[model samples]
Target: MTGKIRVVVAKPGLDGHDRGAKVIARALRDAGMEVIYTGLHQTAEQIVETAIQEDADVVGLSVLSGAHMTLVPKVARLLREQGVEDVLVLAGGTIPEEDHEELKREGVLAVFTPGATTTDIVAFIKSSVAGAAA
Candidate 1:
């Protein structure tokens, strides 16, 4: 909590769309959190590496290509494997309500659907990792 919160906004797999990811990244940065936006087409390893290297307090994965089940959890598992079990993992964009619980079980703390407000997302990150920033 002594330093600003850091978040890694990643677009994994072949998801060419990046507008949503960028929007969230800017929102987090605007909220006074350090955000690292991993551009389009990043693999799970790349995302986890960025999160580790950035010392991210949160990892936000935005997928519109129906690959949330594959991509999101992989990044989470890899992070945990690298001894990063504390990073708050979140998924958004085209993820169904049905998948939310399963994603949570798989290490994702939350999943934001299409209509989720930016304010809610920022608040969630802040509240979820109340004293994690360093």
Candidate 2:
């Protein structure tokens, strides 16, 4: 808790809907984390680069395109490729329940589907990052 929890909220792939991503970004900022939002249509590489440039503690990806499987793992791989193993990778939006375990296996810390509240996301990131730092 010594420093602000920095997080990058991004929309990856061809997904154009950004209301959710923006909402989460604002919520994280209001919760005291430094939130950087990489706007719409970002590639996995771009998200990772922004995360690195921002020195983020977490990367929050919002994908409504049902391409979570493809995009999440790609971002995770890019993070690992960049030697950013400590950054928590989380995804939300229209994800099926069955894919949650698979995403976790691919190194995503948590997956948030629809109906997940802003408080839940914020708390999850805060506690998860704090625990990691501990």
Candidate 3:
């Protein structure tokens, strides 16, 4: 494992909006993690490929198009299919509270809602990677 966390922050499907994703990407990069923001309307395949190619430590999916159930898990599943197990998957943006557990079961490590702070996100990634190392 490297000292810096590599994060692939993706906006998947036809979401058509990217402000939140861009904000999070900026925050993650500013926090000293290597960030690859795969701009708007990326497919599950593209996202997974970026993660695999970048050897990303974390994948932050930003979805607001009500396709969370499908797109988010599809990325996770694709990663696993490609033999990616160490990456910590996380999601944010308009995800319903009720859907969190099912997302987690599908391989997402955590879900952040509208009010979740960047500090919390940075801390979570740091601790999660550190804990996984231990």
C-alpha TM-scores of all predictions: 0.95, 0.97, 0.96
Candidates sorted by TM-score, best first: 2, 3, 1
The segments of candidate 3 whose C-alpha lies over 4 angstroms from its true place after superposition are none
Q: How displaced is residue 13 in candidate 2, in Å?
A: 0.3
Per-candidate alpha-carbon RMSD to the true structure: 1.5, 0.7, 0.9
Model 3 clashing residue pairs (backbone): none
Error of 1 at 28 (Å): 0.9
Candidate 3 structure lDDT: 0.93
- Residue 62 in candidate 3 has what lDDT? 96
Name the candidate that leads on TM-score. Answer: 2
Q: Residue-wise lDDT of candidate 2 within 21-70, one digit each (tens)?
A: 99899999999889899999999999999999999999999999989999
Model 2: how far is 68 from its true place, Å?
Answer: 1.0
Model 1 over residues 45-124: C-alpha lDDT tens digits? Answer: 99999998998889999999999999998998999899998899999999888888889999988899888889999998
Query: Which of the two candidates, 1 or 2, achieves a greater lDDT against the reference?
Result: 2
lDDT over C-alpha atoms for residue 124 of model 1: 89
- Tens-digit lDDT track of model 3 for 23-108: 88899899999999999999999999999999898999999998999999999999999999999999998999999999999999
